[model samples]
Target: MIGSGPALAADGASTETAPAEDVTIVVTGEKQDRTLQQTPSSVAVATGRTIVDQNLISVYDVLDRMANVVVNGNRTSFSIRGIDASNVLGGGDGALASVYLDGAVLPKAALVTGPLDLTDIAQVEVFRGPQSTVQGRNALAGAVIIRTADPSYDWSGRARLLLADKTGERRASAAIGGPIVDGQIAFRLAGEIARSDGLVRNVNAGGDADRRKSETLRGKLLFTPAAVPGLRVVATYMHDRHRRGGLYVELQPPYAPEDRVSTSDLIDVTEVKSDIATLDIGYDLGSGLTLKAVGNYSHIRSHYAYDPDHSADPGQIAVIDDPNKTYQQELRLNVDWNWLQGLIGAYYLRDDNRGYFFGATQNLSLRRLGVDQSLLKLGLPQATVDTVINLYGSGVPIVNSLDQPRVTQNHAAFADFTVPITTRLRLRAGLRYDRESQRRGIDQRVAIDKPLPDPAAYPGLGPIIGQINGLLQATAAAATSYQPERTVRYHAWLPKIGLSYDVMRDMTLSLTARRGYRAGGSGLNQQRGQVFVFNPEFTWNYELALRSAWFDRRLTFNANLYRIDWKDQQVSVQLTPGSAFDKQVINAGRSRLYGLEAEFSARPTATISLGWGAGYSRTKFTDFDVGIGQVLQSAAGNEFPNAPRWTLFGSVTWQHPSGLFANINARYRSAFYQSALVQTHRDIRPLTLANAKLGWQGEHLGAFLIVSNIFNVEKPVTSALDPDGRLRGMVSEPRVMGLSFEGRF
Candidate 1:
C-alpha cells in the first residue's frame, strides 16, 4: 500500500520523502472507504500522476515492477505469489484473479490484451490475496481494480505527444473534461492512438514482425441532480481496435547463432475490435446507509493466424476466428455505525464465447517431391525422377475445421462485517455463497479434393499410388460428427476472519485467515471419446502483518508473512505423447506455498527520496501422481511454473525546488522453471532491468525523456522447444529512448 505522505516525482515505485499527518490514501474495495493503514491486507497502488511520469502504456507495465507479481508471455498470463489466475486444468468458469474497470468486471480475454488508456485513469489498485468474501467468484488468488478520473466542474483538458527510438514507436493522446450544468452534471472525453514498427525482424518476409497499431475512444458522464439530493449516476462507453504482426519465433539450431531477426514462410497476424458499456448508480439512503448498483456489457471479435512449422517451407498453418459477448451486474448496500460497519451484495454474470479453427493435415505432401535430394542421393537419373513425379499427382492438402461454442453463468451473494471488540482491538468476518453453470459444444469436419485411380488403369504404379491415396482417405475419415455437450453445476461457501489491533501510537498489527474456491467444469477426452468432470479446488490462506510510521511521520515501513495450503488442485493429463487433442482434466493432490514481503520508504534529506521492496516465496507440490494403471511420473517436489524464488525492486528520486526532477528504478528476479516437469533445460534465466527518467514541469506544461533497458539485454521472455531440440520463444524488448511533451489548459 502507498503511504500517506508527500511523495517524490511519480515514476513507477513509491518514493516518499516526508509523511504528512493529514494525508491519507483511501482504499475503496474494503466495503467501506478507509485509509490504507486501516485495511488489514496487502495492496499496491499506482496513481495517474505516476503513470504519466513513468510513461506506462498498459496495466502490464504497472504490474511488472510490483512485488510478488509475475506477468508472463505476451502479457497474457499473470500470477500472484506462485498461483496463476488461470487454473492449471483450464476448467474454471472464470479467472482466479479478477480485473475490475470502473466497478465493472472484465472478462479473461479483455484482461489478456490490455486495459483502456490511462489518460482518463485515476488510480490502479492491486489486492494481493484472496478476496472471495466481498469480491465473489474467481477472486481466489487476488484482484486488480481500476478507477477512471471523474468529471470535474472546472473546464480543463490536456494533450501529449511521444516519440521513441529502437522500434520507431509514436503515440498521441488528448483529453477534456468540464461541466454540462455548473453544479448538477459533468462529462469527460478522451482518446489515444499508438503505433510501433516493432524491433524483431523477419528476414524471410522482408518486414518487421510483431508490429502493432491501436486506437481507443472513451466517453463518461456524471449526473447529480439538485432535485434529488444524495443521488448520483455515472455512465461510460468505450471502443478499441488493435492489430499486430506475427509472433517472432527465433529458431535455435546447433549450427547457427542466436537469431532475434528471423522467421519462416508464414508471417502470423492478429486483429481485434471491442465495444464496452457500463453504468453505475449510487444513492445515500441517510442514517449512515447507502445503495449502489453496477451493470456492464461487452462485445469482442478477433482473428489470429500463424505458421505451425516455423520454417521456410509451407508445412503447416492454422487460424482462428473468435467472437464473444459478456454481461454482468451487481447490487449492494452498505451500513456504517460507530460500533459496526458492513456490506451485503449480489452478483450476476453471463458469457457467450464461440471459436472456429482451421488447419491442414499433419505433414506436408511428399508426393510432389519425387525428384528431391533423397532420390538424388539414391543415384537415380533425372529422367527417372521426372517420370516418377508425373506418375503421382501433387499430394492432397487435407483441410480440417473445428467449431466450438460455450456459455457460462455465475451467481453469487456475499456479506462482510467489522465490529469493535475493544478500544484497541477489532474483529472482522465475511461469508459468500456462489453457484456456477456451464455448457460447451464442439463440431469438426475434414475434407480433401483428390482421389486415387483404379488399380487396373495403372498396374505398374498401383502399389505406391494406393498407399498415398489411402493415407489421405484415412485422414478425412478421422473427422466425425462427434458432439459432446455437458452442463456442470457447482456451489461453494467461502469465508474470511481477521483481527486488527492498534498496539502503539502510530503502529498496527493484524492477522487474517481466508478460504478461496474455483468452480469445476466438464470436457471431452478426445483420445478415447470419454466425457469427464473435474471437481472444484480450494485454498486456505493465513497472514500476519505489521504497519508503522516513524521519525515524526517522516518514514514508513510495512511487512507481511503469509502461507497457503491448496487442496484438490486441477491438473491436465495427456493420454498419449505428441497428440494435440488427447488430453484430460483431473483433480490432483495438494500443494503448499509460503512467503514474506517487506517494504519501506524514507527521506534522509528533503531533496531526495528512497523506496525499496523485496519478497521471497517457496512453493512445492506435496503430492502428485499420473498414469493409466501405474504411476508413470510424479511431480511431488517440483516448484510451481513461472514462480521465481525471490524478487527485489527499488527506486530513487531527486527533486529541485525549481520543478526539475530525475528518477531511476531497478528490478531483479531469480530464475524459475517454465513448466511443471522441472527439467533443468526448461528453466528461465534470471534477469535484472534498469530504467531512468529526466523531466521538468511548469504550471500547465511538462517535458521528459526516458531511457529503458539501459543494458540492451535481449533476454527471452518465454520459450518453446520442438521435438527436434529447436528452441524458440518471444524475446524481451530491446533498449529504447523516448521524448514526450504535455500541455494542459
Candidate 2:
C-alpha cells in the first residue's frame, strides 16, 4: 500500500487498482480534467496520500521535492526555474507567481506569514511555466494550486496525533465528513493545532528566539439538488491564526558559531489572523456545455514588532500593523465536444491593503543617509560631526499612525481551446485581456525625541550653529506627514499557443509558446516621501515537453525543456549616493533563463516503488544597469538571486504483505547567490537533506516513526552582516525524530 492506499487522482477520483503501476492520474490545474500524459504543460502533482506517506508537513516541503523549484530559508518566498515569486526586482507591487487555495487567489502577505501547514489537503499542483493565459496578472513566472478535500456522501473521519523531539513540536488534527441529507447534501469539518518551542535560543531574553504556534479550522458544505437535474453547489469557510518569533541568530567571533543563539533583549514577534469564505456553483446544460460561478472574500490582519538593532541596548524598536481585505468573482462556461474542448472565463478582483508603522531611528540608518558628510560640508569639525551623529542615533522618533493604503482592482477575460486536427495531433491556444488599476498614498511624521547639544559649546562650531540647526531640521523634515493620493492603470494582452502530438499509444510530445507579464504599479520612496510608477515587465517562454510510459505501463518518464526571454524588468535603483531610502523601482533591466527538468517513476514490483527528478537551469542578466550610490554599474552576466543551477530529488518505498512499510527520500540543491549585485554577491552554499520513515499499517489504525534531516546537517540557510559588524544568519532546522498515530473511522 502507498500512503493510505493507492492514491486519489487530482480530480478526487480513486486510482486504486490491482497493480499501483496501472493507476492513471488526472490533473485539474488547467481548469480541465485530463490525464497527466495528455496535458501539454509542465506540471508537478502530489496527492493527499503521497503527502501523508512522505510526511511533507508544509508547502515548502512539497515544493522541495519538485524539480526546478527552490524555497528561501525563511520560507517567505520561492523561486521557480530561476524566477522568484516576488519578482527579481524585490521592490514591486505585483508578484511574478500566484498561489490559489480552492478557487480563491491568496494575498501576497499570506505567502509571507503563511498558514502553510498541510492538514486536510486533497491535491497540490505546481505549474512550472507561465499560466498567464488562464491565471491573468500574477502568473508571469508560475502558479501553485491547492485543493482541500470536498464533502463526500459517505460517513468517514480521520485523525492524527504527532510528537517530535528537538523542537518539542506537537500537533493534533482531525477531519470528518458525512451526508447531512442522504445523497442530497453533505458537510465536512477539519481543524488542526500545533505548537513548537523553536530551535534558536535567545540568550538575552532567556527563551527560544524563534518559537511558533498556529491553529486552523475549516468547514465545507456541498449541495446537489435532485430538483435541479445537474446543479452542484459548495460553500467553504476557513479561519487561521499563526504566530512566530524572530528568524535570525547572532554569530560569535569568526562570524560562524556552532550553536543557534541570539543576543537581543526584546523578543521579536509576529502574529497573523485570517478568515476566508468562498462559494462555488456549477450547472450542467444540455449539449455538453456547463456553466460555473465562483465568489470569494477574505480578511486578514497582521501585527509585527521587532528590534531592528538586535542588540542588548534599548536602541530602536519597530512596530507595524497591517490589515487587508479582498473580494473576487469569476464566471466561466465549459464546452466539451467530441472535436473540441475549451473554456471561456471572466474574472474580477479588488484588494485593499492598509498598514501603519512606528519606530525609533537607528544610528546605522543615519550613516546610510550620509548625515556625517552633510555636517562636514556645513563646516563642522570631524569630532563635532561624530558627536552630533551619536546624539541623533537614538533620539529620532518616526510614526505613521495613519494608514498608508494601497487599493488595487483587476478585471480580466480569458479563453483557452484545444482542437483536434487529426486522431493523433491537437492544437491548443489561449488568450487573456487584463486591466489593472491601483490607488496609493502615504502619511508619515518624523520628529526629534531628544535635545541636541548646543553648537556654542564647541570652539569653531558657534559660527555655523545656524547652519547645523538648519541641517538637523532638514533631516527631520525629509519624510512628510501628508502626500497626495496617486492612481495608475495598466493593461496587458497575454496569449499562448501549443501543439501536442501522440507519438504512440503511451507517448506524447508537445511544443508551446506563451507570453507572461507582471502588472505595473506605483510605489512610495520612503526617504523622499514621493510616489513613482514603473512599467509592467514581460516574458516570452518557449518550451518542449515529452511524456512516455514503458514496460507494460510499469514505468513513466517526463521531460520539459524551456527558454525564457525577459525584458523591461522592474528593479530597485538608488537615485543618490549612500542613501538607502532614495531607492525606487524602475524598468531598466533585462534577463534570459533556460532550464530542463526530467522525472521518472518505476514500480517494478507490486510492493516496491521508486521515483527520481532532476533539474538544470541557467540564468543570466542580458542588460542591467543599477545605481550603486553615485555610480551606475552593469551586471550583464550575473545570475539571478537565489537561483540554483541544479536540483535533484529521489525517493524509494517498500511494502510487505504483512502491512509493514519503509520509505526513504532525499533532496539536493546546488550553491547559488543571494544578491544580484555583482560586487556584493555571496554564495549561499549547497545543501542536501534526507528523511526516512518506518511504519505498520492496519485496516483502521496506523503508527509510524519518522526522522527528518537524518544526517543532523546544520548549515546556514541565509546570512547577512549586521550594523554592529557581526555576522548573523538563519540556520537549517536541526534533525528531528517523531512518532505519529493515525486513525480512520
Candidate with maximal lDDT: 2
lDDT of 1 by residue, 1-745 (tens): 3221243221112222223333345677665777666777787766665565566678877677677877876677688886777764344446789888877677676654544456556667778878887887788888888777667677878788989998788989888888999888998898889999987677776788778888988898889999999998889998888777765566465322235655566677777788889998889999989998989998877777776655554555678777778899989898898898888899998987855344444333343222233355567677755554455443345566677678889899998888899988989889999988888776667676445455457766565456546644654565444677667789999999999899997799999999988888766554344556788889999999888888875677888899989888777766544344456777775789999777776666776667677878888888775544223256688788888878787777676768697778777888878877645654678888888878986667878898888787767777776422367777777779998887777
TM-score of 1: 0.88
Best by TM-score: 2
Candidate 1 lDDT for residue 206: 72
Between which residue pairs do clashes occur in model 2? none
lDDT of each: 0.72, 0.80
- Supply the global lDDT for candidate 2: 0.80
TM-score of each: 0.88, 0.94
What is candidate 2's CA lDDT for residue 145? Answer: 87
| Cα RMSD, each candidate | 6.0, 2.9
In model 2, what lDDT does residue 529 have? 67
> Given candidate 1, what's the lDDT at residue 650?
78
